[model samples]
Target: MLIGYARVSTLEQREDLQVDALKAAGCDRWYVDHASGAKASRPELDRMFEVLRPGDVVVVWKLDRLGRSVQHLVDVMVRLQGMGVGFRSLTEQMDTTTPGGVLVFNVFAAMAQFERDLIRERTNAGLKAARARGRVGGRRRKLGSSDEAMIRQLYDSGSVTVQEIAGRFGVSRGTIYRTIARTSKG
Candidate 1:
């Protein structure tokens, strides 16, 4: 049995073309997921994989429909292979049932892994450069030690309302409340 998988990023998008293509390609069953490819949890795809069996061919109209990243696609392919399921991508002309197709998939998988490594290396280098330039990353603390101590003192003495402290400290009421709660916890 050939199981077809179709995907669209948004609910507004149509799945007609993918469904027609998959049916035309001789798919016996079909699954459709209307969600972002970047998301790891795809409910429809999970269900399809769980129900797939030996001699089952998982078909997609295009390679992108299978995954957002090449690494992700290869991981899914490996999982399918381990389950004795075959894979077919119409646009990429890939069929995991054949030796040639297996070779092609392996090569693509290796390249994808290499690309990920390069991205990680580049990101690390960029961060190092930024640090050398004295650029601190992430958010700054809302309240300094002196302000925090005063806030705690005021709260402990019950001298001021949370809204009054927030207005005086130039912060939100929630921030004032949280600070009081945190100081109380300590």
Candidate 2:
């Protein structure tokens, strides 16, 4: 049996294209989910994996729809293979049932991981260069050190609640709470 999986990032997005394509590809049953590719907890995907059996084929519109991380995709594919289930991605034209397809997928996965590593390297280099030039990182603090000290003192005195301190300082309660937490931890 061929089972299809379709996903969109948000509930507002439509799954029409993926659904139509999966149906056209002769999917016997399909599951759809409105979940982000970066998110690990996808109920539909979990259910599909649970129900998959030997001789079953799992299909998706694209490799990205199944997972964002190459390691994650490889792990999922390995699990499916262990269960004697075939996996296919329509857009990438990858099918794990065939030797050639498995090779192609492995190459693609390597490239994806390499690309991410390159991006991280470049980002770190840029940050290091910026730091050497005396360029400070991150958002400029909305509240200065003096303001933060005052907020902390108010909280320590137990005279003002976090919300009250935040209101007085014109900051969010989270900001006030985080400031207090940071000081306490340090």
Winning model by lDDT: 1
Worst 10 residues of 1 by lDDT: 177-186
Task: Score every model by TM-score.
Answer: 0.74, 0.65
Query: Any runs in candidate 1 off by more than 4 Å, and if so which?
Result: 151-186
lDDT of 1 at 42: 96
Per-residue lDDT over 1-186 for candidate 1, one digit per residue giving the tens place of the 0 to 100 score = 999999999999999999999999999889999999998779999999889999899999999998888899999999998999999999889999999999998998899889999999999999899999998887886998789889989877788888888989999999887777766754
Give Cα-based local distance difference scores for all models.
0.92, 0.89
Q: Which ten residues in a row have the lowest lDDT in candidate 2?
A: 177-186
Pairs in steric clash, model 1: none
- Model 1: lDDT equals 0.92
